[model samples]
Target: MSENETQAEVGTTRRGWTASKVLIAVVLTAVVTFGMTALLVNILERRTESAQPNHNVVELSDTTYDPAVWGQNYPQQYESYLRTEEMGLTVYGGSQPIELTPSETDPRSVGSSSRLEDDPRLRIMWAGYAFAKGYTHARGHEWMLEDQRYTVRVLDFNQPGTCLNCHASMPEVYDELGNGDREAGFDTVNAMTYSEATQHASGPVACIDCHDPDTMSLRITRPAFVTGIAALKASEGIEDYDVNRDATTDEMRSYVCAQCHVEYYFDGDAGNRLTFPWAEGNHIDDIWKYYEEDGHIDFEHEITGASILKAQHPEFEIWSQGVHADAGVSCADCHMSYDRSAAQKVTDHHINSPLFDANASCGTCHSDDAETLVNRVVTLQDRFVVSRNQAFDALVSLIYNIEEGMANGVDEDSLDLAREYQNKASFYLDFVYSENSYGFHAPDYTQSVLIDSMDASRMGELALEGASREDLEASEVTQKYAQDIEDRSDLEFLR
Candidate 1:
């Protein structure tokens, strides 16, 4: 063939190739568009399904204690709630039971090489209080009533009726006491003895605690929460704040959990009235100051003789300062996220640490995969463990130092400041120690708290060595606080 014939043939081949490519691209585009449209439709369908409330079962009473009654109407949520009975352990959180033994040489050490070990310092710190007798690892919400009934802290110690505030189906008790008058019910129940209150616990934490029966709109049932939140708002300069009226839907998601999972105390003078010490700010220091200025000592330290304060579960308070809260995430956002597939969508009421269901909990907001998020969480917890242990070691040393100074004939006046240091130091350390998060909830805040705790512990130790209050207050830990260096033979140290 000639050169012109060859060029014409080559041009024809090129044109044919271009035509084939265009046809393939059109087919691929149609498939991609169809897939995207289907995905969008499915998402919208799930949203609509979840948005519509469950309306299948019978009507429930406002004061229903049995979750099964609520379960009848909301089977998915109720069934998920039952999973709290599962004793499965996550990496850092969960109520997987671990055996703890009081150390043979040191009864104060509650952990026998397990995380369940109650810091030995806790015994010293909570001395003369019921917690000193019995404190255990916190379990799931299902055990709220069970734990309360059986703990030595309750049985051995004389807990008032106010103890029932968070552990029982409080709505039912309220109804029984006030003849269905919720407000009047609170006053009546508040006056009951612990034994009388025990008779009132119908079941575990139930739907009525956080919901309005007629509408199923979230409502605060506990009277303490109503007053506590009002006080909290007042502290923030909001007058006459009513939770049922003032709280936004987004705020209700968190406010519901905050009802129970917050720091509280029994107001001994006025009929053991359950109180949230939020008249001050929610910070560790703020609460401490409130306790100090108000002369609200939980117990006198039997060993150090310092009037000490006890912290309850303050998850909501501490978490309120974290990045998640700042970014508008609620407790329910992670703990009660919706689990939707092609068929159904509803909130998973299996309330737990977000670490348990990373895909639904963390992955919902995070771009990372579940495994990455889990690992990231584990790393954060590990950091807290190191800091917490450091603080713990320092605290134990301080306790021993104070005891030693007392044994060596240190004057009560000079050692009085040491006792004061021990009081503040242990409170700081125990605040983090008792909180269930292990520091995953608020990493930066957790670290700063632990750092201050370590500083206080070392200061207490130095005060035992004749360090002045000014020096103790200004001093910082330049080295590792000593650990497990206590003399076991000393009578005061043994106590």
Candidate 2:
């Protein structure tokens, strides 16, 4: 072909590609938009015969922002965005000034607990990872991105490209690093590090927390979830995540928040940063069952590269199985309760525990007095709290025993038993403690903790039996307790 003819062909191909790209971008941008956002309104209309208010929304005076824009489109959101900065020192769950201590709050926590006080089995379980270095719970979305940004040497973050999928500004990552190729951007950032990419992320969880600012619509910013859903569908030969059909409006209320609230982990083994084991189903048993069956997990130290299964907060999913979700209530319905103004309305974005505002959260639905509902939640919470309290104490003892076995040169069998006791016991207790809802509010989970704790204690006794005291002392996994790696023990590590 002539050079002129070749150039014409090239131009034609480029034009086709460009058009396809634009079309794809527009369609994708629309898919993730939030359906619950306040309806858009025309501001400059005179009191006329045809104008009608269709939604319950607040009336705006002239201009705070342009509704046509994305980020600036939601002034109500912008106004409520400031709540993240509010002081919640006293607010146990959602209050701002949350200074948590593993010891002060729950002395039986992983690092602080007496049960895991000195067991080295975890070192094996979390081999070659920072979790081995010592992991803590204060790492919220806000904190994880900060220190990681300033750190010189960062995490391997490469174990699963899926780790960085959602904990980022999807658009920005997709742009600077992704080269504007939607598919390529996901691949690039999926493989990027929290440390390397954090320099690019500065804002707290907000509009882009679970959405793309290019459109003021709710969108799934996490690739792991998006891909997970697709993979789940593929595995089952299904392809529908219209979030709408999966649940009710109330379920979406919480599922919307669950968009960020539930448990998840970087699946290094599969090289896929997958969400929980939900493909099998969504309850605690279902997810755990999926994990056990697929073995899709890190199973390694998150920091030092050990094998481990990092159980994220399964509150939303677990709650979905509870009376709240079963009754058709959502996390948003309670947490982001709504209020109205100028005939317009909006759900509060403060995002706090419902217990803080009983009337708005519980009273709105149940035909009970504020005190009664408060008592109901508290009663449920307290019931489990008691069992959990016992479980916590038991777990602490289990850790100490495992540490004792390692320290006392116990036999291999006994040492193994000690390790098992501590790991399972502590993990079980921590799982319940971490649930965002207090026990009464999330009863089954609370009960599950107690049951699991009992199992851990039982198994712990077996680990203690695995080793002779002398052998345990010689082992590296346990060397802290030179005395009494024996019969039943007590939890006293934090003290």
For each candidate in turn, the TM-score is 0.80, 0.64
Task: Report the C-alpha lDDT of model 1 over 254-325, residue by residue, as the tens digit.
Answer: 999888888888777867777888887788887888888777777787877777777778898888878999
Q: Alpha carbon lDDT of residue 242, candidate 1?
A: 93
RMSD of each: 19.7, 14.4
Report how far residue 304 has shifted in candidate 1, in Å.
1.5
**Cα lDDT for residue 201, candidate 2:** 45
Best by lDDT: 1
Q: Indicate the residue-level lDDT of 415 in model 1.
A: 86
